[model samples]
Structure formats: structure tokens, C-alpha cells
Target: MNTIKRNRKNRLSKLAVVALCTAMLAACGSNTTATTSTDSTAAATNTSQTTAASVQTASLDLSNSKVEYDEDDAYSDWNASEATTIKLNGTTATVEGTGAETKDGSVSITAAGTYVVSGKLDDGQIVVNVADEGVVRLILNGAEIHYSTSSPIYVEEAGKLILSLPEGTNNVVSDGTAYELADASTDEPNAAIFSKDDMTINGTGKLTVEGNYNNGIASKDKLKITGGTFEIHAADDAVMGRDLVAVKDGLFVIDAKGHGIKTTNDTEGEEGLIALEGGTYSIESGEDALHSTGGLLVSGGDLHIAAGDDAIHSEIALLISGGMVDITQSNEGLEAGSITIAGGEVHVVSSDDGVNAASGSSDTDGAAGEMPQEGAAPADMPPADMPPADMPQDGTAPADMGQGGGPRGGGMPGGEGSSNNLLTITGGYLSVDAQGDGLDANGGIAMSGGTVVVNGPTMNGNGSLDYDSTFEMTGGVLIAAGSSGMVQAVSDSSTQAGILMTYPQTQQAGTLIHLEDEAGNAIVTFAPSKDYQAVYISSPDMKKDTAYSLYSGGTSNGTETNGLYDGGNYSGGTKVVSFTAASTITWVNESGVTEASSGFGGRGRGGDRQVESTQS
Candidate 1:
């Protein structure tokens, strides 16, 4: 049986393939662009409060933040006769070699190392004032800068700033929605490539940024992106790094209003992390598409987000061992305080809670790396209950209680900021679609393997497995469809094996729930995009007495991808029940192994609250 913290009650919430094939055969046999580094992380950020005793810590322990880099930052095939070239002429910039200077239309540089800038500066500004702590290295080959009033590549003083874009070259940087400030008491040079100190951007060319007066590559300390192919359009924040934003590979395409790659050192111990090891991101943000205040370590990468608010918030520690994420939208799709998924392939679409672990809830939910204050628009999120007009349409009663009898609208868990959250799925593959709470944790949850699938919340206060102090499945496979007033299952000390069916009505939306295995095989060939009255399933081929068989409006040709299925040939559906798994949870309906109720309010722990398992 499973016994990790079913009562501790706090509550809460990519394969970086073959080093991307040896960095694409070393950028096609050294034509340039091959820095390759992605491997080093150690995020555990220390959290406390998880009290019910047991906690061996299932994941998120990558290793002490590796941080390497420096062999002259690994160079990239240079030699325009070994140094300064500058050239760029439009509004004027013909430095023709030696440490640079072009005055008024701008071109500064002041000495240090490799330059090779190349072409056009229209309204001008390539400044990089290197003094005494010099370490500049610019190499934008086909460059193009265009300042309309301010920053068009200004780095005022550098101790480090390597900006190469080798391979087939194509650089461009623009800024101009109005700026004119070099130090308006502090907005100093808002972005369009405005670095103040540590920065890095390596080869394979094709960079494009158009930050209309705000940010698009701002760096005041540590920022890294080991290969290039960016395409940003920021009005505010699209690749910032006041202290750290490492990515060992790259191919981004962002559109930000603020935060789509951030790490503003929020000072307090100054950790400001975001260490994604490799890359292929595609963000669209109005706020948060990878925000970090201290730790957010995605081991490798291939992210795809579309956030209006929070799609990967990490105010402390969030860890995904490898990577291939895809959040189609979000209000919250992976918030963190301490979260850990040991491997890859995740997909979420949230309006709220599709993998949340509320600990300081991102400080106020969304202001992530700060600066967004003009029109605003991301606050809402508190509505869930309204569905109990006297609920109880079947599936064996007891879900709308609330006053003394307990059990009402959602699963309950006690008080105080909810333990330290802690959600752990040991391997990969998660898929969720939520309106709210589809694998939520205020304090405890730990699955031993992977494969989770949820399509939660059709009202009745949000559920499809909400946890507040206990949910521990031993191995893989979970399937949670939504709305049964507030259904929940899994916690007889889980040793694998679980089941909860519900349904007396609503079930339309791709319906099709299969399960088989009497002589057939297939356990849960899915289908559920929305409408559901309930259905939970845990598996390792659910045994005990064996004999399973649940079907329902099916017809599998098989192969399906996110709706599940794998190997065809099923038929019309409707078989409904034939259970036999004896215990560790199995409470069916549509007239089958149904029984247990009067629970789901607080202690579904040892009592199991709803288990029947004896129908065949």
C-alpha cells in the first residue's frame, strides 16, 4: 500500500536529442556555430513545512548548478585578420580597423578583442565602451542596427559580452517607440540589445529583434544562449537576465509583452535562475513564459508556450529532467514552489491549475520578473463552486454535504499556506486540460512512474484529482476525466491499482473509455476532451482477482495521440462494467461495483472513502 503523506495535508499543487545530433554535425562541418554545452543543474532550493513524516524526495535534484564556460568562451572560427573591422555605414560608421570610433552617428568600441561588425546602422549606436575589465567579442557579420532614439546595441561597459552570429549571417536589431534616455534616472537603455556586463550569444546566425523601446535581450550580468536563430518582438522582456538565463542551445521565436525568458535576480540571496539546457522554444506571452526568481531547471529543451499569464513560473524550484513541453495557453500551467517531473513530454492547457503547487503563488501570480504596469489584465481566477443545487443524480450519492456531514464541492485539506506543496511524478508524459485543478497539489502528491492524463473540471468546484495532503500512485498510468461533484480516489496507501467511475448522466465529448483484459489486453484506450461526469483509473493492469472490462461508446481504430489509444481494433463501445480488482480502490457505476461515499471531504486516506470492487 502507499503511505507517503496521504494525511500530511499541505496542499498544493525533450529530449534534447543526441546533443541535437552533435549540434547538427557540428553546424555542418564547422562552417561556424557550434558551442554545445547544456549539462549541469542542481535545483532543490530548500523548502520546508512538509510535515507528515515521510519524504525521500522523488526528483528535482540535478546537481549544484554546473555553470562552466570560458576558454575564451569557446570561440567560433574567427580571423578577419584577427580583430577590429566595424564598417556599418548609413548614417555613418566606417571604423576600418583599430579599436573603433566614429563619433556623433556613433560606433564606439574602445578596444579589447575581435569585432567584425558589418553594414548598416541607419540612425546609429554600436557603442560598447570597453575599459579595464574588457572582454568584448562582437561578430554580427551582416548586422543592421536602427536606433530611433536610444539603444540599438549599447553595452556601455563590458567585462564580458560575446555576441557572435556566424554561419549564414543575418542580424538585425531595432528600437523606437520613443526612448531618448541614456539614464533618465534609471531606465538607462531599455533593450534592443542593451547589455551592461555579462552576455553571450553564439553562432549559426539569423537573429532579429524589434523591441519598440523596451526589452529584447537586456542582460546586466549573466545571460547565455549557445546557438542562434531568435526572432523576438518585445515591448518588454523577451530574453532578459539580470543574473542568469542559461540555455545551451537555441531557436526561439518569441513575442512578449513581458517575460518570455526572464531572470531578474530579485535579490534576497540572489539566485535568479533559469537553466534550460538546450533549446527550441516558441513563446507568445503577455506575461510569463518561463519566469524564474531562483530556480527553474529544465534539463534539455523544446518548449512551446502561449501564456497570457504563467506558463512555467518558478519562484523557487521547478525541475523537469529533459524537455518537450507544450502549454497551449495558461493561467497556471506549472507554477512552482517545489515541483519535479523526472523526465519529459508534458502538455497542458490551463485556465488555472494544470500542475500547480502554490507556494507564494509566484509572489502575486504574475508580475514575474516585474515591469508590466500599464494596462494590466491577468488577475481574475477564483470562481469554482457553483454546481450543487442539491446534487446527487446517481452514481451512488453523498457528494454535496458541506455543513457538518462534510464533503462538499471540492476535496478538503487543512490550513496554513499548505505545507511546502511538493508534487512529484518520477518519469514523463503528462497531459492535462483544465479549467482548474487537474492534478493540483497544495501539499502532497507523488507518482512513481509516468503517464498522467486529465481533462478536468466541468464545474462543481474543480477536481479531477485535487490534492491537499495525499495522492501517491506507485507506478504509471492515470486517467482522470472530470466533474462528479468532486470525485477523488487513490490513497489506500497505493501499491498500484485504482478505479473510480461515476457517471449517471453527462458523458458526451468523444466519450469512449475502454479498459479490457480478460483475454484481450488493452487497459484504458482513452478519449475525453471535455464533457465527463467522472472517471478515474490507475493501472499496472489492475489486478487482485483480475477480470476487468469497461467500455462505453467506443470504436477505436487505434493509434490516437493525445486522446490516448495505441493499436487499433475495438468496436462500438457500451460494455460498462465487469470488475474484480478487490480493493486498493475500485468504485464503479452504470450499475456495477459501486458503494462507498460520505467521503472526499478530508480523510479519503485509510478509509478509502469510495471503493467497491466486486462486480463481475
Candidate 2:
């Protein structure tokens, strides 16, 4: 029953249903519907507070975690009458279960059993200290648990822990701002819901966790959630799983001073992985919203994230096959050693590189670009006097990252050893509005199918599309608009036809740019989000030696999706130029077909931002 959510055939957002069902089968051995979207407008913040970290060194496999779905989901649906009731009465609790006993301000469960908890605990704790290898199930039936100086629900040891939320129940758990741990040297159980063993949270009820101390939920081992509604506010990470964090379905509203959801098993093995297969998430975090030390796979869900740092980050592999993602605020929207997008509808608004593929080891990864100290807030980026593009980010500089800029090889000479850092997009629709480089890769990039629209950097230090190695495009439409400086065109080896046009001056924002074929057929119409002096367009309709007319300030009355217009009537636009696309790349200006590298690219971030072009 280990089904993968590789249903990329659902090209639209509605196709997420099919992927969600497959994810449920893989996670819970059941089929379920996707979570509905909420009307909370908290995900609209567009300005980022941090900058992106560059790359170091590491090679990681870009594989999915196909861990088998266990039978934990069944525990949530168990008979309520069979569950032993643990009724809480203010400071003390009366347990009707044989394995539990109440002490001073604490309730200890010593054996594996099904327990129902309700009522209120103002300043007490529930500690499950089972020694034997037996799974313990706890059903929260409208329970309110608050603890001072310790975890509210602490699983010291267990074969497995199940936190089942019964339907129609609203469970609330909170922790104090500090912890008096049993071992101060290690600081164990530092979250509101801290488990030392594998844990699973299932059912449709709501769980509210306020972690004034460290984290909202933290598991030392694998943490899986099949179904639940979680509203978590945390001083540290909202959810942390040492081994793996797998979610089949959930509705989550997360606001964290640290990372929203992350895995931290950076030691060895396949730990530190996060598989977000299905969910509806609205996250606002000071650091990376979704981060993984190993690999991150997001196949099905609706994610609206506003992050101060990177929106989604993985030290190794980051794969998005099917989903809907809106990164409303981020420094670097997506960052990883390798980023592969097979299918999805993604929108990014960032202050730095929108999608960055770089090679970085675990030792070099940190929030806001600097290595973080133990419990300190992530250091912010450049001050008011500094420009974001001029910062000394040594690892991300294209010159040192092997971007040679030519068709002979993507990065290294002859394209050898250029795959270490890569950004691959096979199918999807990605729209990016960035203040820095739009799509950046430290090594190389390849695109076979998809539509990419980038309104890139207005600064002269960054480009709309920046790659260290080479970019191979076989099929897809790519439209990028940015400044004239630091511009890099596609390689001449690409099978698709593309053209780069530089205006005499910077064009204003919302100024429409249109392209029409000789048959008067509109190819593409876009309005850049920022002022741009360069426009690049690559389309399937662009045939070799075929003339196309370019227009400026046009009115497109068609359906618009992320600046690209389709089936629209374009009028009132002045004709700019008429040129034929080369077999690969054609760089044009007011004086007809000009050379691709006019000696303008070698001045900024990378001195070799040069590309060979063909005369149109």
C-alpha cells in the first residue's frame, strides 16, 4: 500500500485531490480528501527580512522517502468506551486506568494502554514513562493541559506514542517559557508535546499548542501525522522530528519565531527528512518556513508561506511534484543542493534569488545566511546603508560557483562535473517576482516542460536568470525581464528558440510587452513587476528564421496568469522591433541583432556572465 504521489498528470491545482489520495494511501493506508483552504489573510507579507545563504560542499541523493505506512491511524478511531478515563480536576487528576497514578502536580502513566483525557490541568504535566515495547494511545477529548517549567505531554520512553484527537474536541496544550530539565546538560523534553519515541497524531479534531519555551511539538524519532488540525505558536521550531516528519493530511496555522516545520537529524542515515504529502498550511516564520536536513518532498497540498529567510529549504534534495505553493514573502524562496519541480502551480515573491540550487553541507546551513548560535535570533542581513546585492556572500557568487556561461558546457568546460548543483524543471508553472536573481543555480539547469515567468532584479548586480554552468532547454516557455546589466542568455545548444531584447532605457512597471508572430498570432504578453531594461522570451511558437513582431505598452484583454496573457486581444502598443529567432538564442537591441555579450555582463557578481549567440 505504499503509493507515491507522482500523479503529475493533474496539471491544474484541482489535480491535487488525486495526489492527496495517493499520499494518504502511502501514509495511513486510507484514502482521504485534501484539506480546505482558510480565509485568513495572514500570508500576504511580501518584504523579506533576511538574505539567502550561499553554498559550501556536499553531494546528496534526490530520492523520496518511501517509508511504509503503519497502522497508527486506526488508534484514533478506537472505541471510546474501552478507553480508561483520566479526568482532570484543576491541579490534580483522578485516573481510572490501571497503569496511571497521580503525584504532586503530575500524572505518570507507566504502561501501554488506551487512555481518555479531559477536563483541565492548570499547572501539571502528563508523563508517559513506559519501559516495555508497547504502543500507548492517548485520546484527547476536549482537554486543556498547561505546564510550568516542563513539557505538558512528555513521552519519556515508549514503543510508539499515539495522540488521537477525537472529533468535535478542542485540545489545548501550553508550556512555560523555561524548562527545568532532569539533565540540564542535555535539556531534554523542551517542547509542549515532546516524545522520546516514534509518535503519530491522527483524527479530525483540533489541537492548539503554545510553546513559550522551545518548540510546539518535537519528537526524537519519526513523527507522523495522518490527520489533525493544528494551530501552533512557538518561540522555536513549530514542529521538529529528529528522524522524519511525514504528514498525510492536516490543517495547520503555524507562526514561529524560528523555523515553522523542520527536521534536525543531521548525524547520519535517512533521518532529517520531511515528506509533506497532503495539507493546508499558512505559515509565518522568522526563519525558513519549511526546512529539512536531508531531503524534502512536497507532493500534495496547499501552502501559503511568509518567511523572513528562505521559504522552503533542504540541505540535500528538494522535490515538488504536485501541489499549489504561494511563497508570499521570502529572502530566497526555494534553496537546496538540488531542486526538481515535476509538477505544481507555484508563485514566489522574494527579495533574493527566487529558486536557488546550490551545494551546501549541513555545517554551512543557517537562517538568514549566518550560522546561528544556540538560542539567539537569526542575524539579519545588510543594514540600511548596504544594498542587498552588494553583500559579501562568498558561497553564492557565480564566479566561484563554476558558472562559465556558454553553450559548449553549462558550467564547467564541456559540461563535465556541472551536475553537482542543479535546478531541474520537467513540468510546472512558476511565476517569480524577485529583487535579486530570479532563477539561480550554482552548477547547471535543465528544463524540458513548463512555463516560467520571472520579473527579476532591478539592481545591476543580479540577473533575471543566473546560472554558473549551462542551461539546457528542450521544451517550455520562459519569459524573463530585468536590468540590462548582468544579463545572461540561454546557451546556443538549446533545442528551443529564444531571444533577448535590451531597451534603450528602463521600462516602467506595468508596462506591457507583447510578442506576435507573422500570422498576427499573439505569442506572449507580460507586464514586469519592476522596471526592466531587458526582456527575454522563449516559446514553442518561435521557429528558426521565423519573424516575430515585438511591441511595448500594449493592452492585453486576455486571461492573465502571473503576467502572461493568453487568448487576449492586444492593441494600442507601439511596435518595437521585428526580428527572427535564432535556432537557439538571439540577442537584439535598437541596432538590429547585436552580439550576445556586449562586455556588460562581466562587471557584476560573476565576471564570466557571458553567452554565445546566433545571428537572427
Number of the top lDDT candidate: 2
Model 1, 286: alpha-carbon shift in Å? Answer: 3.6
Give lDDT tens digits, candidate 2, residues 97-164.
58888998678988998888999999999999898958889889899999988999999999889999
Lowest summed lDDT window (length 10), candidate 1: 1-10
lDDT of each: 0.69, 0.70
Which parts of model 2 are misplaced by more than 4 Å? Answer: 1-67, 361-419, 597-616
Give lDDT: candidate 1, residue 399.
41
Task: Give the TM-score of each candidate.
Answer: 0.37, 0.80
Clashes of each: 15, 5
